[model samples]
Target: MSFFVSDRAPANRVSGYKRRIVLYCLGALLLLLVAVAMGAAIGETAIPLDVIGKTVANRIFGAGYTLDPIEEGIVWSYRISRAIVAASCGAALAVSGAVLQSLLRNPLADPYLLGLSAGASTGAVLVTVIGIGGGMVSLSVGAFWGAALAFGLVALLAKAAGGGVSAQGTGQIILAGIAGSQLFNALTSFIITRSANAEQARGIMFWLLGNLSGVRWDDVWLAVPVAVGGVAVCIWHMRALDAFAFGADSAASLGIPVRRVQVVLIAITALMTAVMVSLVGSIGFVGLVIPHAARFLVGVRHGRLLPVTALTGAVFLVIADIVSRTAIPGQVVPIGVITALVGAPGFALILIRGRRMR
Candidate 1:
């Protein structure tokens, strides 16, 4: 009689894989720090490297240092806020992208394609063109609602199509998102065409393209909480996200209660995405493209994939923002434009490769 024994080799292989992933993540994190420092140092005013060093040190440690008031003001106020927004928006978009891709089981999935960004842009454009908000904060709130409405509509449509959240055939949901995006985009164009104010028109136009300028500290407060909460929600559902890799039925067989978990997961992602898009306008490509890149690096396991994607995204955007500001001295290019230029080609390549595979 032969006794069956459990194999330990597979477990060891898994352990080795995890170790390599950890080491890669550490290296990525260090690169992210370098990217951030470069972003902070090389902006419009060109803050000295020493000044950048000192300001960061001051913020990181409670250490005392001296600098000219003008230099201190520039580093602490203008440059830092923009850089922080850059990183925050990057991480938020990246993680949101990862969540959306996993939810839909499609690499092409992104926040804007799902209509969240366009919807939010429409709401905020109305405010910008009509001068609805007496204050900046109120306008952000308007954008948030618009974004939330778009998200809701998509969710409703997905449920109607027999895949409320857990259904793995994402073709229907993706089509719905595209339709929703077009609807909102047309509405936004209508608003812009009817507007009487040129300044408002320009502002609305710029916002739609996406930018990191005109950002103040108050915007950070709004963006940070939503992003953090979204990340937390995603982390909690990492296992569920992993289950999605094999499609919904496989997940349900594994006792994941696919439908219920999916609705909650999508809802959380939509909320977080709306807030970020509303704050920064429709920054495209980062959410869609970054996750695919991360997957290539770390595979599709959401446990490791999510955080790595987030960090890579943050690094990408920070570098993008730096280029936007400094690429031409007088013109502050919109951050969204930069991301699109970088992300669109990669997306097209992914689509082509996916088609070939099919």
Candidate 2:
């Protein structure tokens, strides 16, 4: 005598799914704004959020809002620049991770895992120590070349190992990447030890561990555009990335030029990584961990996944940078250390979850 209840239709289900995606994106954006504010406001000297807003408004609009020079310097010059750089680097690394994971169809794939960071680091070190390209050369230029070299080597090695940007070839590529990273890292260590003095070594060590202490507007200008552009490019290629999730054969059958897409995406990733590493020196884990965390929230669709991952990474790293500066009263911990401490545990959880799913 009971009446059957009406079932939800497919259109309704799709609408509901989209609603959830929108909500997730909005939430992430809100969190990112809060994190940015916190990062700008909380530091060695704790500028208020109101002061931050006034300083920003005054700068943009030439409003007559006035603050002490020290407050202005702390809020406008230092904290804001550092936060922006952290956000840019985080977004770049996360986007690179998402691209790499999709390209390789391997959960653990990241820009650093592919040797880009080590290569860039080597290039920067060479420039710093040996004065490569004469004294006029910038570290960013060296990093760009270094990253390109590493990428080329990894591709060559992968090709020799019979890995041609396909899922079946992922293991070979990973091994090649590991080898390339070790080789570059060894070269970097040797150069530092052989050439750099103790003071120079200390500076290099801090940079290698990832420092944001000296980030200025110039760094913000350098990093933000590249990161934003890179993210845009990845989003434009979301369809190809989606095809890649199914493997090369399937992607090719779906009319995606698998090799071409792989090459382009890998180049973009390397470019972004090099830019960030050049500015901040090789911060890790954002690329390795953020994509997986985003996937948990947004599913595997790159449209939703990429934006969420980028936003989450921006928020995560800004907060991490805040902790790095404030954690020790008289000393600033390297941003990399905080990320590793946070990311390692998160990574372990991901491993446990993956095992359970399998």
Best by TM-score: 2
Residue-level lDDT tens digits of model 1 in 1-358: 1232346667778999999878987897788777767877887777778888887677678566887778777777777777767777888888888887877777667767568888898888777666676555466777888888887787678668876554653666787788888888898888888874788778778877887777767877777777767777887899988988888888888998887777777777778778777777778888889998888788888888888888888889889988888888889888888888888888788778767978
Off-target runs (Cα >4 Å) in candidate 1 are 1-29, 57-64, 133-137, 161-163, 166-171, 349-358
* Candidate 2 Cα deviation (angstroms), residue 353: 2.4
Best prediction by lDDT: 2
TM-score of 1: 0.86
Residue 228, model 2: Cα distance from true site in angstroms: 1.1
Root-mean-square deviation (CA) per prediction: 4.0, 3.8
Poorest 10 consecutive residues by lDDT, candidate 1: 1-10
Q: After superposition, how far is residue 250 of candidate 2 from its true place, in Å?
A: 1.1
lDDT of 2 by residue, 1-358 (tens): 1233234466678889999878977887788778878999988888888899899888888887878878977888888888989999999999999999988878888889778888988998889888999888887778778877997898789888997455466777889999999999999999999999898778878888888887899989989999999999999999998998888889989999877787788878888998898888878899999999998888999998999889988988999999999999989999999999999999999999988999
For candidate 1, the per-residue lDDT at 264 reads 77
RMSD in Å for model 2: 3.8
